[model samples]
Structure formats: C-alpha cells, structure tokens
Target: MKNILLFIALTLSVHTPLKGFELQHIVEPSASMISLQTQNLCHSLYEQKGHLVCLPWSNPIVDTGKISLLAIAKTNEKGLGIYQRARDKDLNQSFLEEVFRNENFQDISGFAEARALYKNTVFSIIPLHFAAGFKLNNPSLPEVHFIEQRQTQIKLSTTWFLDNPLTEEWMSYFIAPSIYHFDRASSSGDYDVLDSATTPYKDLVQNRSLKGANADLALGWSSKILWLPSVTVHGYRLFKESSDCSTCLPTYISLDSLNAPKADASVSWTIDHSFGSSVFGAVIQGKRLFKSIDQDQSAFAYIYKISRLQSYASLSQNQRSFGFLFDANLYQLGIQYSNEIQATALQPKRINQSYAYTALVL
Candidate 1:
C-alpha cells in the first residue's frame, strides 16, 4: 500500500499539466484550453441547474462556477469535439460523476492522460467492502461491562462504477444525486440480548449473521471547495424484520468544509458528518504529506482529516462517521485502498475498515 501511494504521488507531481504551454498567459498559458474550460463549466452549470429545477430532480443545491483552465483550438464544428483537455486541482466526488459522459473514465482512461473523446468516455472501479460501528448506550446498560469481542461487527458490500469518472469536473451538483446499491452485515458478531450465560442469544451467535440490503444516494459538491453545503441519504433495512428493529432509523450524513485541495498536487482534505442511533461524532480529517522518489512517474498528495464524535446519540446528540481513500499506479498496474468509520447504537463502540483493488489503464 505504501509503495503504491508513493508511486501515485510521484506520477502526478512533476507532470504539471499547466507547466507545458507558453509563458505568455501568467507565466504559463494555453488560450484554447482556457476557452474549453470556460465553456464546459458554463454548460455544466446550466445542465446541473436543469436537473434540479426541471421535471423531476434528484438532489442538492447548485453546481460549479465556471472557471477557465486551458486554451483550446476551437474546431467550429461540433459532434463532441475536443474543446479542451483541462485539469482541475480540486474536483470533488459529485462533479466527477456529472461531467464524465462515460463514467469510469478514471479507471479506463489510461491513468489521467488527457483524452479527447468525440463525446466518448471509459470508466471502471475496484470493488470495495466495509464493516464498522460503535455503541453509545450508557455503559451501565450491560450487567457485564466486558466486551465479548473487542471488534465491532463488520458489515460488507462491493460496487463497480458503472459510469465512473476520473476527475470531479465530470461530477454534477454542489451535491450531485447519485445512486448505488449495497449489502450491510450485522454491526456486531456479539449479541446484545442473549449471552453465553443467557439462553437465547448464546444459542443464536453460534451460527448467526446479520445481513441486509441498502440503497445509497450521495449529495455533495463535485468539487472539493470547503465551507460548501453537502449531504447524503441512504435507505436500508434487513431482509427479514422483527419488532425491535422495525422502526430503526435510516442512515443520513451531511458535510460542510471550507478547505480547498492542494494545488501543488501534494495535498488532500476530508470532512465528515454521520448520523445513526448509538454513535454521534464529527471528525475533521487532514492530508498526509506527499513524497515521491520520482516526481514524474509518481503522483504524491498530502491528506488530512479530523473526526470528533460523542459516539453515543440520543434526542440531543447525533452520530459522526468518516471515510478514507488511497491509491497509486506503477506503469499500468495499480492498487486502490478505502476506509470508513461508522458509529451505531451498540456497546463498546466499533470501527469497520474496507479495501479496494485498483487498475490503471496503460
């Protein structure tokens, strides 16, 4: 993992996209490239607004403000012409989904090379699995305070980016509304009702599993500008139902940050907000400093995150959650990594981790 991260850091670092053009436009400039960026951002904003105010909207507020990134050679004719192959410093998750006509371009577009598609895009993603949660009830709820298992019960799920994007510019909305399906496992392997000393739970844990289906919808700015309003909505329930678990609250989260991503290609920022029954906390994450042996072949970026939560929710308190992503590529082969922190209503509080397999196009 460390090696791959190092490689990506190196690959993206020295190959400054903006450094190529002439020194006329502010030390370095590409007039045509700039036009393309301005046009696209304008078109994107118009399209995004249409999604919200039109017939049937899906998610959030507004999308990106237009910004000129490059100077492109205009072709006059149009059928998905290459207006420009621009680069964005802080493309957020949602915008990436919006702009990429063909999602999964990040995984399929040959490692971020400037690709000109006649309105064509290629995309894919490494599947991922996650399981984690923490309990927040008063410690006194349990007669025995000892954790049957120190680890929280892990739930798992996997997804392929059907229409994935490499850069956030492809994404739509201040918070684009996108959907994906997931399966959640029981939050704990341990039991709350029946124990070894107890009759029912002891018998159940022997061959027990907690599993359910979930549908997730994301609402956040495609760009990573901080202090922006963002949100998410998820609907999930066990395949089977019981009296105690029937009315369980659904999951929701909101994040708002003001930090911009690093322009040096060596920094990242993360902000989070989680809502659940037992866990309640907010973490402000930071970027890890980027370092690369080869500034050309590897892309290094620093990342930082902050998380602070009560871990126990109630009428007054709420839950806080977190997620992390890391990846790198060497030549063509590549690997990806991801992590998420969930807090739920349980004892001892739990945390779940996740992993992904990455493939970079040659």
Candidate 2:
C-alpha cells in the first residue's frame, strides 16, 4: 500500500434531474496473497484432495468465508524460467495463477538481498458511496436523497464486457474519495478483531488506490465470458487519519459518467505475458454496497487499499516481505496486518524483516 491520500476534488454536483428521494452508490471488495515460493506453496493452495483443500492448493487458514475465491502465487514471475522464450506476449495458465495469488513461494540467499530490490506487496480495494437521487427527474423520487439506502438494490446495467481493448497510462490525481480496509493474519486462523463498520474508519484511506483493472482474459471472473478489454486503474486517498480533521483531494480520472452501482463484491486479478502491459494492474471496482435484513440496513460494506512493491520485476525483481494486506471479517469482528521487510548489508549482510500489527476495527 503506497501514499493513498487526497483524491476528493468536488467539482459541484451536477444534478441530472430527480423526482424521488432514492439514493445510489457503489462498492468493491478484493483480497489476494503474494509470495516467492518455488512451487512449494503453489501446490498447497491449488491442489484439492480428499474433500480437503490440500496440496496443489493454498487453503485459507479459516475454512469458512463469504468471498467467492482465494488466489495463491508461486514464482511471482511470468513465462517459465524453465520454458518458453523471453517474449512475454503470451503467458499461460500457470503464470496467471502464480502472480494473481502472489503468495511468497521463493526463498533467496538472504533477507538482506531480498529487501533491497522489493518495492510493493499488498491486498486491498476501494469503495465509493454516492448519496444522490437518480432518474434525474423522477415523479416519486426526491430531488436529492441519501445514497446510503440504495446500496442493497445496486446492480450492473449489463454483464461487464471484455475484448473492448485495454489501456496503458494511469491517471494523475491525489487521494480520491473512497472507502478501504485490510487484515494481516498470523500463522493462526483468525483474520481480525475490528468491526467491519469501524474497519474502514470512514470515507478515506491513506496510500490507498481507488481502482485497478486488468484485461488478461485468463484471469477474468467470467474468464470465458466478459472481457472489459481496457486498461483499468486503481487509485485511493485518505480523507481523515485523525478522529475528526480536514479532508483532501482524492485520485481518479474525473470522468463525469464513470460512476457505477454499489457492488456487494469487488473482483480483482492479473495476467503475466499473456496479457501484455509492461506494467499490468486492474480492479473490478465499484463505489459502495450495503446489506439489510427485513428492510433494516444490517451492514454497509466498503474498503479502500493500495500497494506497490518492487518485487517480481518483469516477473522477478527485488522481493520484500514488507507490505500491507487484509481479509474478510467473520462472526462479530474484522482483521488487519502490515509488513516491513528491510535489508542492512555489512561485511556480514543481514535482512531485518519486521512484521507487526493489531486486530479488530472496534
């Protein structure tokens, strides 16, 4: 997770014309694992055996989760060091799986050398909530309403399409108006102790991203179907680090019609040489999504997160264990964790890796 602050540039809400007091918002949630395993952790996360998620698989420490899938990594690289030529225009399934999951699979000569080149490692997402009245001029709707209540009915206008052609350049903006959260798990199964409500803190986050989109068909949610063949962007911002303080601008493309519905799920993924982009990143991002039971809003879910490390350069570069990450909450609480792996080289070079964090959003 990098500098995710200041992306809120309020350009005066241009009301489209509304009649009802209905609201609309969007949300996206994402989670993944990045590592340098040499086919070690790979087989463990992918392989399914005897009704148990075992070898060839990386199972969640906790068996139960609301999320649909869990990604795991191996070489953090694309194209085989064991196969194919240097051309990365077309990577295979193995490559896509490894980088997407991004679980630590490889061990270097020492920590000192590993930390020197590593740049980023993190698992996160960005959520947006728009409390606006849609259908501009609706007879039953209010001119303006709290979008907070519209999250539950949020839905996509169409099944997202791919093959639309991807993009390259990322936008230029500071912290964007968004929601974010994450958890760092110890060897233990517990994810966090925070309440999902308290986890994101508020509408802003630090060194986070608003969205990240990828076009590698192999990693697609409807991998065989939807193809949003365009360059996706992941941006974020921190509105408040203090309990109650002044906010700042957020990062984004500033597209007037780019906003979407509040999504209960935020899909994310990546592709190696197969999906060419000297730098590849994307997010199935949305603005917000809340839940309710018996007409009573039970919970509102949103998150904002960003992370860029210098590891796996061209598929293999400076690797660092120091990064940011989070997970889905359970029972009554949420979870969070951060990592910082550094290197100090003397005649006796040493790699100082420190992993410390707290659990709970209360």
Per-model C-alpha RMSD? 24.8, 24.3
Per-residue error for 238 in candidate 2, Å, reads 4.8
For model 1, the stretches where C-alpha displacement exceeds 4 angstroms are 1-175, 185-215, 218-327, 330-362
Model 1 C-alpha lDDT per residue in residues 183-296, reported as the tens digit of each score: 222222233332545666544332222332222222223323333222211111212232234533322110000011111111212243253111111112112122212122
TM-score of every model versus the real structure: 0.24, 0.19
Q: Kindly state the number of residue pairs that clash in model 1.
A: 87
Clash counts for the predictions, in order: 87, 120
Model 1 C-alpha lDDT versus the unseen true structure: 0.21
Q: Pick the candidate with the highest TM-score.
A: 1
Which candidate wins on lDDT? 1
In terms of lDDT, the poorest run of 10 residues in model 2 is 109-118
lDDT of 2: 0.20
* Deviation from native of the Cα of residue 240 in model 1, angstroms: 15
